[model samples]
Target: MKKFTAHKKRVAITTAALVAIGGGAAFAYWTSTGSGTGSATTGTTVPFTVTSTTATGGPLTPGGPSQVVEFEVTNPSTGVQRLQNVIVTVADEDGILWTDAGGCSYKDYFVSDAVFTAGDVAPNGGKVTGTVTIKMNNLATNQDACKGLAVPLHFSAS
Candidate 1:
């Protein structure tokens, strides 16, 4: 009986050792490399809107005090827009290049362009104010054709 019991214990120990070795071997794996691909998209940029607000100096007179032309810029885009400068030009009543008539035209006026420090305008409804001086230059010739005529100004922003 003693001999039979010892043989049984030896058999169980050998089976357990075989299981531990086999279990470790079962987890072993081969290392290798592979690859694949991906994709994406982007958005678009738009222009700004400039509008004249009011004039602070005067009804222009030849060789008289210059008027400060006040204006504002509107950012209609969804993202912040960069503002660099605002340029004011004398436009016809129809907002185009003035045509010479009775000696009154764009050539008779001088406008100082307004420059701004580079700044970011907020998205949508963001506004910034600027001013340019407009003067009727004292020409050597007559400018009576401009008397009582409403000056139309065109504003642009960049």
Candidate 2:
């Protein structure tokens, strides 16, 4: 093996130490801040009517098998538009909803901000309000199912 010069050895050791220290620091940050779980910065602010929000679905016991979120969107602008996309998330938890494709339906499941838009709000008397359902897997086994799920229904006239 080729022997490294004294200076070269010292430099190599220092670089290795720096890398180790950097990795440790990063790990510390992740645990301390819990920043990856639904960081507030990820939510999109879409306009829609603030209808009633209800938790549906899930197992049958005290716990349950899934959860459903229902909301209403009113244009009030008297225009005729359609609602598009749905983005639902839970804080500090995985997203538990069904909305992979783009359109208006309460059957598909998954987390999405997919584009819930309502466009035809007739001048001052146009409005649309409906219920959207979100399903959750075995809530009993997961226990921490709906921990960090936040759903903001976004829509526009189409």
Candidate 3:
């Protein structure tokens, strides 16, 4: 009877030891290191559209009162943009003919460039107003060549 009891005790102790070892192995994991690469793209900018709105102080005679040229700018871009100033000039159209047969050219006119720190325009069809001045410079020659003629003005902004 003593020999049989000792044998049963050894079997129970061996089974417990095997369960503990297997449970520890189940919780174990492997450690490792790794790396990868990625990339992204950017967007482009679009130009603003500027148009003449109205003209005040004009009968536009030679050496007459200067006209206040009012204009509006449209921001067609997706983001807001800054406007520094607007440069006004006469369009170079060779088709321009004076009311009289006498010759009239862009040299006979003067347009003042506008300079102002305007507010940032909003995105997508936003508008802002600005002004410049235009006058027919009084030349020593006969000025009747420009009488009753409509002058074409060009506007550009930064």
* Top of the candidates by lDDT: 1
TM-score of each: 0.73, 0.32, 0.71
In candidate 3 the C-alpha lDDT for residue 93 amounts to: 35
Local accuracy of candidate 3 as per-residue lDDT tens digits, 58-116: 59888889988888888999888887777777764333422334677677888887744
**Tens-digit per-residue lDDT, 8-111, candidate 2:** 88899999999899877843334353444444544333354544465566532222344555655554543444455434443222323333333222232233
> Which candidate order results from sorting by TM-score in descending order?
1, 3, 2
For this target, which candidate reaches the highest TM-score against the unseen true structure? 1
| Model 2 score (lDDT) | 0.44
In the order shown, what is each candidate's alpha-carbon RMSD? 4.3, 27.1, 5.9
* Model 2: per-residue Cα lDDT at residue 113: 39
lDDT score at residue 112, model 1, on the 0-100 scale:
88
Model 1 residue 150 CA deviation (Å) reads 1.7
